[model samples]
Target: MSKVISRDGTIIEYDRTGDGPPIILVMGAFNDRSTGAPLAGQLEPDFTVINYDRRGKGESGDTLPYAIEREIEDLNALIAEVGGSAFVFGYSSGAVLALHAAVKGVPLSGLVLYDPPVEGYDGRLVHQLTELISAGRRGDAVEFFQSQLVGMPEQVVVQLRNAPFRPYLEAIAHTTVYDTKIVCEPPKQEELAGISVPVLVVAAEEMRDKFKQAAELLVSVLPKGQHLCLEGQSHHIVAPVLAPVVKKFLLS
Candidate 1:
């Protein structure tokens, strides 16, 4: 395990492995370095993978009064520790952070984003999620997020409850507000136009229509972006499968 101290003095912990171009893995809500371990394992052979615990989870520190800019600084601090610019891949809310950083002029080798939930596509679901959080039903918030954001079926949600991810899910359940803040507004093409690095926007074939729309928006707006749809997969199943695609795009 490696650690980098951010400008704000938060200790961001990460695992560094493999050999080749550095690929930083930014996990979505409810995931830390451990939860993203499998996807990182798949890409380790071809790329140097940096999987980390974002603020408030795992071995990282969290300061109150969270601002999205701090998360961007966290990524910047990690990239600096790894010797500067590298390929970046973000999933869900993490994708929003990556996109924001890229637009802010972070030097990225390339980028791969999977199923990011941006605003304006649907407002009712976001309102419901906020309601769940306000009610202090963290577990229910997680379930609602999976079903509403990722469009998971009730049966699939039940299956996930028994998976090893249950704890991680619970950890970020209380942080749904943070996710909502990041996704409150749809990403602007003008904001994305500044990203000059190659990009791959991956979407799940089985995800909700909104996810597909979001992916399309990213691809269309990014200056150098390509879109790829993963057949027979949803958000959870697509991460590992997309890891290789990311490796190919970044390493090529």
Candidate 2:
């Protein structure tokens, strides 16, 4: 693991591996660098994969009074650390952050977004998540998020409580609200239309209306962009299946 200091003086920890064009992986809410590991390893042979804990998760340091721009600044710092411009791939809410960084004029050769949960979510949900975290109900927060944001059914969320990663979800429950702040207001189409870098937007064919709308916004608005829908893939994508398509797009 390595560390980079952000413009705001926050410490961001990351793992850098392989040897080629660089790709930084941004995970969704409740996910840290480990969530990015499988995709990172798959791309490492052709890209210098930098998998990092977004601020407030894993080994990354957090600065109070969180704002989305601060998170964008974190990625900006990591980009500079990796050396100027490079490709960036973000999953779910992290994909929203990647778009925010690009639209805000961060340096990037291209972008790959995998099913960013971009939506105009209700404030009540965010408020509830905040209350849960504030009351030290991290497990409930995790279940609430999976059922709401990830669209996992109630039964599945109940079954998920037994999964080994449930603790990891609890461990990062504090960041769930941070993620809500990111996705509650997605970049307007006008903002997306201004991105000059090439973008590859991928979503599953079976994705719900909102997800499809979000993915379409990315492709339809970006000046240079393409869309791909995996036949059987969903938001919870299979890395081996995802890596090849990403490689083709990034290398194109």
Candidate 3:
């Protein structure tokens, strides 16, 4: 494990592998660097892959009074550590954070996003989460988010809550609100108009309509962008199919 101090003095942890132009994998909620491992392994041969734990999870540090910009800074710090600029690939809400960073001008060579969970997150969800965490019902907080926010059926949530994953979900439950907070207020289309870097927005054909629409809408707003939908794929991209799409885009 390696570490880089962010602008706010928070230590961000990351693991690096492979060789070539740097690429950082930004993770979404309820996940740390581990979530990026599989995809990272696939990309390692063609690119140097750096997968890190986002603040407050895994081995990374967090600061008080978190701001979305702070997370953006965290990503920038990684970019700086990897020789100033590199390509980036974000998954789920991580894709949203990547765009936020790009709009703020993180030195990126190219950008690829895999089915960002763009729609459905709103201010009200943040409010509910804040209230839940404030009340100290962190477990219920996770349940509510999985069921209501992610649109999982209540029955499925109940089953999973009692399973082994519950502890992991609850362990990082507070960060759920943090994820909600960052993506809650999306940037106006005009804000993203200035992002001239090449971007590839991806969607899985079997994924939910909301995310598919989000991917399509996202591509529409970017000045230099393209779209691809993988056949026989779902929310969790099949790395074999996804990696090549990314490799082709960045290499071109």
Candidate 4:
């Protein structure tokens, strides 16, 4: 694993693979570098993939008081390690961070986002999550996050509960608060207008209208942007379909 120290003195750990322009994979909640392995493996041949554990999970350091800017700094540090500029692909909450980074003027060649959760769409969803967090029920918080925030079906949630990664998901479930902070506001069309980098907003076929709207909103705001929907796919199938799209956009 390669390591880079962020400006705030946190040690970030990452796995580097393939041989081309660096593409950093920023994971969403409930995912680490390992969780994205399958998708990363597929893109390894075309781009130098940098898959890293976000702070507070896996091999990265987590100091007190988690702020969204620090996570942005982590991305910057990773980009610096990989030769100053890169194409970035982010999923869910990580996508939110990537958008914020791009708006803040990080030197990115391109960006691809998959279903980033932004506030103001379905206020009831946020209310339910806040209630769960208030009750101090971490498991319920995780479930609400998957079902409500991620819009996963009941059957999918049940299957995941029985899956091997259940423990890992449970462990980082509390980090939803961090995700909430980063996505507290919906994507601003004006903010995205300043980003000159190419962007691709992807959505799953089964994603709700709100998600599709969010993707469309991003496409509208970005100076050079396009939108694609993965046919016959849902939130769970995002990584596999997304890898190819990211490869094509970044490598083209």
lDDT (Cα, tens digit) per residue for candidate 2, span 123-143: 678889999999999999998
Q: Evaluated with lDDT, which candidate comes out highest?
A: 2
Model 1: lowest-lDDT 10 consecutive positions: 118-127
In terms of lDDT, the poorest run of 10 residues in model 3 is: 114-123
Instruction: Estimate the TM-score for candidate 2.
Output: 0.95
Q: How displaced is residue 115 in candidate 2, in Å?
A: 0.7
Cα error, candidate 2, residue 24 (Å): 0.7
| Number of the predicted model whose TM-score against the real structure is largest | 3
Q: In model 1, state the lDDT of residue 242.
A: 76
Question: Candidate 4: global Cα-lDDT?
Answer: 0.80
- Every model's Cα RMSD, please? 2.8, 1.5, 1.2, 2.7
lDDT of 4 by residue, 22-66 (tens): 899888887788877787888888889999999978888876577
lDDT of 3 by residue, 147-217 (tens): 87677887898788779878888887889888888778666688778899999988888774767777777
Q: How many residue pairs clash in model 4?
A: 0
Q: Which stretches of candidate 1 lie over 4 Å from their true place?
A: 119-137, 143-148, 151-168, 238-240
- Model 1 TM-score is 0.85
